[model samples]
Structures are given as structure tokens and as C-alpha cells.
Target: MESFSLLLRGFSVALLPWNLLWAFVGVVLGTVVGILPGIGPALTVALLLPVTYDLEPVSAFIMFAGIYSGAMYGGSTTSILMNTPGESGSMITALEGHEMARAGRASAALATAAIGSFVAGTIGTVGLTLAAPLLARVALTFGPAEYFALMVLGFSTISAVLGETPIRGLVSLFFGLALGLVGIDLQTGEARFTLGLPQLLDGIDVVVVVVGLFAVGETLHVVSRPHHASFITKVRGWTWMTRADWSRSWKPWLRGTVLGFPVGALPTGGVVIPTFLSYWLERRLSKNPEEFGRGAIEGVAGPEAANNAAAAGVLVPLLTLGLPTSATAAILLAAFQQYNLQPGPLLFVTNPSLVWGLIASLYIGNLALLLLNLPLAPLWARLLEIPQPLLYGGILVFATVGTYSLNSSVFDVGLMSVIGVVGYFMRRFDVPVAPAIIGMILGPLAEQQFRRALAISQGEMSVFLTRPLSATVLALAVLVLVIPSLLRLLRARAAHQGRP
Candidate 1:
């Protein structure tokens, strides 16, 4: 009851007219960037972080939270309309959502996605509010070794298991970790890889890396190709979900919420794992699995629910332990630093207003998103009519402007070109960009923690395994890396023996 009262008070703060307006604006901006390919919540939030430096704390947090939630909703729009997934979390939705569009049931697909998303986001936020304190207590017990091991597990699972190929994924991760090493050494302040350049000493900015790899890379890749699809889609029929659609969708939404939270709480890539897991679960239990690749409504409902639920679930660990399980969450963590705040076990006590108010705004933001997206679906779908050249060209310009605005560094713009070219080749070779981003973000943090753990134990490496939680996380990391090799060997053996 005490927690409930505090949460209500938090809602009172979030419900202020000014905060609500910020939330609305954040959602709109989030949706626009989400509809565009390449740019996402991470890039948008990163670009906006400095701008928030002078804003009021509550309103700034409200806007950032709205962007966090809205990005999930925005990704589904592109997945359904363009067959180009707005983000990796929506890839599963694209599988079914795009198919539904082809079946001329785009409205049904969009309706169910929006509703399921709202349900999941609301429930997941409730779960977070209820469970966060207990989770934080568990996290508080973790020593440096445990945190280091947990980070290792996070890096291994996200990089090894989620991409088109584990090799390509690791290669991409290596590229990122390599880039992360470009800055001066933290412990000694010695230049490791700067090659005597003054620009390299300050380390590459997160904004520059994100903009270069995600924005510029995607734009260049798109420009390299010439798309010839028709300008307009034939959107038809009713916009509201029918009773039958509701009956078919509600169960998956529930199941997805249940499946999504724990995975989201874990230190893997944000919502992608849970979204894909829900899609696979729905397909397996579907009354007609054949309907899966051919416009199965459950596909859209389940993944969308899981996507938002997972998005909300990620907030629990992020706020409680300062462990960002996804790229966007990492950027949010940086935003916390930007505000001279740290988010870990002590955060609730230290910054109760910011923490609880952010949680409360989540409920408000989810409702706002549902209302905004329902009748506005057609407006977003119109993006399909814009010429790819013009759209991607605009992306190139915006990315350049945003990057330059950060530091006005012409050298960063030049470096962006280099990173963009590398990213272009990475995409061409089926390498996943998410892992690269994750690796870049987490690499230095992990190194610092690893060093701290060693210092605490007098350089004894066995401390990592002596701690129960550390051992578990390290074992999971090893298993994650080794399982794919085992599976490949098993497949090869079966093929050689002509076994089914």
C-alpha cells in the first residue's frame, strides 16, 4: 500500500499538463524517426540528450520515457507497411504483419498490433512497479565479479545468438570493440590506438558512432540500391478490430506478456529476443501453423505484445542495477549520466521523484500512444509513397546535421564517412549491427568492472568462479558461445549419415 501510494503520487507529478505535453511531443518525434529506416529510439535519444541538459528534470524524463515507449510502437508501422523492419524487435512482426498487408488485411493487423502493444506495455509497467525493489535487492548483493560475469554473459548472448550467423556477428562485435578501444586508456590515460591524432584522444562520441553506423550507413546502403516498387499501397476496409480479431489476439497477448518479462529482465539484447520467442511460441501453438507465414493474426499480436512488454521489462533492470540490456537502454544510461544521475541499487533512495515519476509516465505514455496511433495509421503509411532516393537522401543530411551539431567537429563528420562505409560492408555480408552497437557500448564498461574485480581480489582470477552468481553468469556465457558450434557439428553429422 505504501508503494502504491507513492506510485499514485508519482502519477500526480507525471500528469501535470506540461509533462503530458512533453510526452505527446516525444511520441510524435519517436514515431517519425521510427517510421524512417535506420534512425531509431537510440539515435534519436542520443541526439536529444544534450538538448535535455537545460530542461526540467521531470519533463526531460517524461520525454525520454515517451521516446522509449513510442519507438516500440513506431517500429511496427514500418514493419507492416514497408516490409523493412524499423528495428530488430519488429522483425517477427514483419513476418506476419507484412503478410497480412499482402492479404489486404492491413487494418486488422495494425489494429491488433496497437491494442496488444498497449496491453503489454500497461501490464509490463505494472510488473515493474511491483517487482523492482526486490530485483534491486538481488542486484545489490552482486559484487564486482558478479557484475563482470553478468556483462560477459550479456555480450556473449547478444552477439552470438541473435544474428544471421554467429561468425559474422562476432566479427561485427570485434569491429565495435575495436572502435571502443580507440579512445585513451581509462586507467593510465595512455593512447593505445590513436595513431598520434589529437581527435582520437577524446574517444569517439556515442552520437557519432551511432549516427555513422546506423544513419549514414543505412542511407548509403539504400542509395546504393534502386528500388522500383509502386508509390502507393491499396489500403482498404474497416480500421477497427472485429470481435473475432479480438478473440484470436487476446490470448497471445497474455501469453506474450508472461513470456516476455523474464527475458527482458535478463541482460541480453532488449526486446528482440522476447519478440522472436513469442512469435515462435505462437506459431507452435497456433491452430494453423500454415497460417503463420500467410497473415496469421496471432503472429502480429504475440510479437507486438512481447515487444512492448519486453521494452517495459527492460526498464526494471536498467533502473535497478544500471545494467542496460539493449543498445537503446545503454543510450538511456548515458542520459542518466548526462543528468548527473546514476541508476543502480541506490537510485530509488537517491532520486525517488525521477524514478517513480518516470515509471508513472509510462502508464500515461502507453495510453497516449494507443490514441495517437489508432486513427493515424494511414498518415504513417503514406511514407511508402515518398521516393526512396529523397527519403534516404534526407536521412543522410539529417544524420550529418545531428552529428555536426553535437560537437561541430568536421573531423567527426569525416570519421562518420569512414564508419559508414565499414557498416555498409557489414550489412552486405549479413553481419548484424545491433551486436556491434552493444559491444561498443559495453566494452569499456566491462573492462573497467573487470579491472575493479581483479583489484578487489588481489588479481585473483578465481574470484569470478568463487562467487555463485558470477559462476552462473560466466557459465551461461560459455554455454551461449559453445552451443552454436555443437549444433553445427550435430547437423553435419546427421547430414553425413543421411539421418533425418
Candidate 2:
């Protein structure tokens, strides 16, 4: 009842005319960028962060909610039409969506995807509304030791789950950790890695790193790669789903929401896994299983629902725990910092209006996306025809502008270029960048908690292990890192024995 009252109050804020306009604008812009190949929601948010600096936090976040949901809705367009997934989450959508396009059911494919996204997004938002406060209350019980242990678990799980190999992921994490150390030491008040550059005192901006890695780095890689032509299927007209389509889609939409929300709220269960699982599950449960490899609407509906639901679920940990589970969540964490607001249990208490208002805006954003996407999808499909060189060049320009605007310093721009080059190489070598962003954001907080725990224990090293909750979390972290290697070793040994 208390939560419901707060949510009603949130509606008051979200329904304000200017805030509503921002939401509309955000959905429109998010949809536009999401349709473009290689520019996912994370990169879109990073590009806009600098521009949103002057806006009120509530309005900025409201816009971001729209952007987040709209992008999820829009990414499917390209996946269905061009067979080019705007992000990893949409790859499953492309598998059947493009096939549907080829079979001249492109409009039906788009309709099911849009409606399914609306259903799952709304359901997932309801989950977040109910879950975040309860989780925040639970988190209130955490001591510094427990918090540090939680951070460790986050680091371990992210490194283990994100990249192709845990080793590469760990390397990326450590790289971010090293960067996190460049600013002034919080405890000692001494410079560590600034190397006498005064600009380094405040630390490297996350916006810079995000833009470098996502925008500039991605652009460089695209330039170096061999060009591939994309095909866009035109939507002949606004189309409605048939009764058969609804019969098959509604169940997957519900099932996807069930599967996606919990996993997405986990520390390392990013959007990609739930989407893949939903597709696989749909295939197995599908009445016409043979249709899966063809133009099955179930494949399009289920995975798209899971994708949006997972996106909404990502907010749970971000809002309640101050942990970012995906690339977009990491950038959203940065946005919270931009407003001098810290996420976590305290945020709910300190800024209930902001938190609940953001939640309310999500519901509004979902509606706005449904309206915007259904009619404008054909127009958005035209975005697929944008020349890669021109699109990427515009991204670089925006990246430079956004970074330069951060501190009005040319030095920041130079640093962004350097980081961009590094990001390019990271991409080239198949290193995952999300873990690095996660590590950079959480590394400093982890360090602070570690020092606090030690201080409370009077320099006792056993404080982390002696505390029951802390010990449990640390044990989990160790298991997360060790289990994969143990499994691999066992598999290798079994293969060797079989050969002999």
C-alpha cells in the first residue's frame, strides 16, 4: 500500500507536461538511434549524457527511461528487416524475424515484436516496482564487510560471465581497476597515478571512457573491417496480427517475462542470456517446432519479449544495489553520479520521489514506444540504408563534442582519443568492454568499503572472513571464478582418458 501511494505520487511528477515532452523526445531519439546498426542503447545514452547535464535530474532520468525502452523496441526493426542486430539481445530476433521478412510477413513480425515488447516491458516494470524496495530494505542490513564482499562477487561474476573467456574479461576488469586508481587516494589524500597532470586529480570521467569504447572504438573497428551490404525489407503497410499469431505469441510473452526478470536482476545475468534461453525454450515448447527455423512468429515474439523484460529487470540491481549488470546499466549508473545522486538503499530513502517518478515514467515510456514504433517502423527501416562511413563519422564527431563538453578542456578530448584507440584494440582482440566499465565504476567503492571494514576491525585482516554474511558472499565469489575452470579441467581429463 505504501509503495502504491508512492507510485501514485510518482505519476504526478511523470505526467507533468514538460516531463512528458521529454519522455516523448527520448523515445523518438532512442528509436532513431536504435535502428541504426552498431549503435545500441548504451552508446546512445553515453552520447546524450553531456547534453543532459543542465537538465533537472528527474527529467533527465525520465528521458533515459524512455530511451531505454524505446531502444529495446526499435532494435528489433533492423533485426527483422535487415537481419542486422543492433545489439546482442536482438540476435535471436533476427534468426526468425528476418526469415519472416523474407516470407513477406514482415509486418506481422514487427507487430508481434512490438506488442510482445509492450506486454513484457510493462510486466517487468511491475516486477521492478515491487522488488526494488524490498531489496533495498534487505541491503540496509549490509555492513561494510558485507558490502565489500558483494562487490567482489559482482567483479567475479561479471568477469566470468561477460566475455568469451574469463581470462580476457579479468584482464579488462583489471585495466579498469588500474584506471580507477589514477585519481587522488581517498584515504591518504595523495596523488597516486596522475603523473603531475592536474586534470587527473578528479579522475577520468566515465563518459569519456564509455564514449571512447562504445562510439569511437566501435567506429574505428567498423572502418577497419570489411564492409558488408545490408538488405532492408519494406513494410507494405501498417499490419495487424492474426488470431493465430496472438494465440502463439501471448504465452511466450508471459513466459519470457517470467524467465527474464529474475535473471536480469542478477549481478551477471545480462540481457543476452535470457533472450537466448527464451528462444530455445520457445522452440522446444512450440507446437510447430519445424516453423522455428522458418518464419515462426513465436521466435520473434518470445525473444523480443525477453529482451525488453531483461532490460527492465536490469534496473533492479542498479537502483537497489548500485550494481550495474549490463553496459547500459553501467552508463545509467554514471548518469546517477552526474546528478550527485548515489544509487542503493539510501537512494530510496533520500529520493523517493525521484525513484518512484522514474518508475512511473517507465510505464509511460512503454506506451509512448508502442505508439511510436508501430507507425514509424517503416521509416526507421529506412535508417538501415544509411551509409556506414557517414554514420560512423557522425558518431566520432558527436563523441568528440560530448567529451569536450564534459570539462570544456581540450585535454579531455585528447584523453578520449587515446582511450578510443585503446578501446579499438580491445575490440580487435575480442576483449569484452562491459566488465571494464563495471570494474571502473565499482572498483573505487569496493576499495572504500574494504578500508572501512579494516578500520572497524582495527586493522584485523580476518574481518572479511569472520563475518558470516561477508564470508558467504566471498565464498560465492570464489566459486563463481573457480567452477568454470574446474569443469573445463574435468572435461579435458575425461577426453584424454577416452583417447587412451
In terms of lDDT, model 2 sits at 0.89
Assess every candidate by TM-score.
Answer: 0.94, 0.97
> Which candidate number has the best lDDT?
2
lDDT per model vs. reference: 0.83, 0.89
Best by TM-score: 2
Q: Indicate the worst ten consecutive residues by lDDT in candidate 2.
A: 230-239
> How many clashes does the backbone of model 2 have?
0
Off by over 4 Å in 2: none
| Weakest ten-residue segment in model 1 by summed lDDT | 230-239
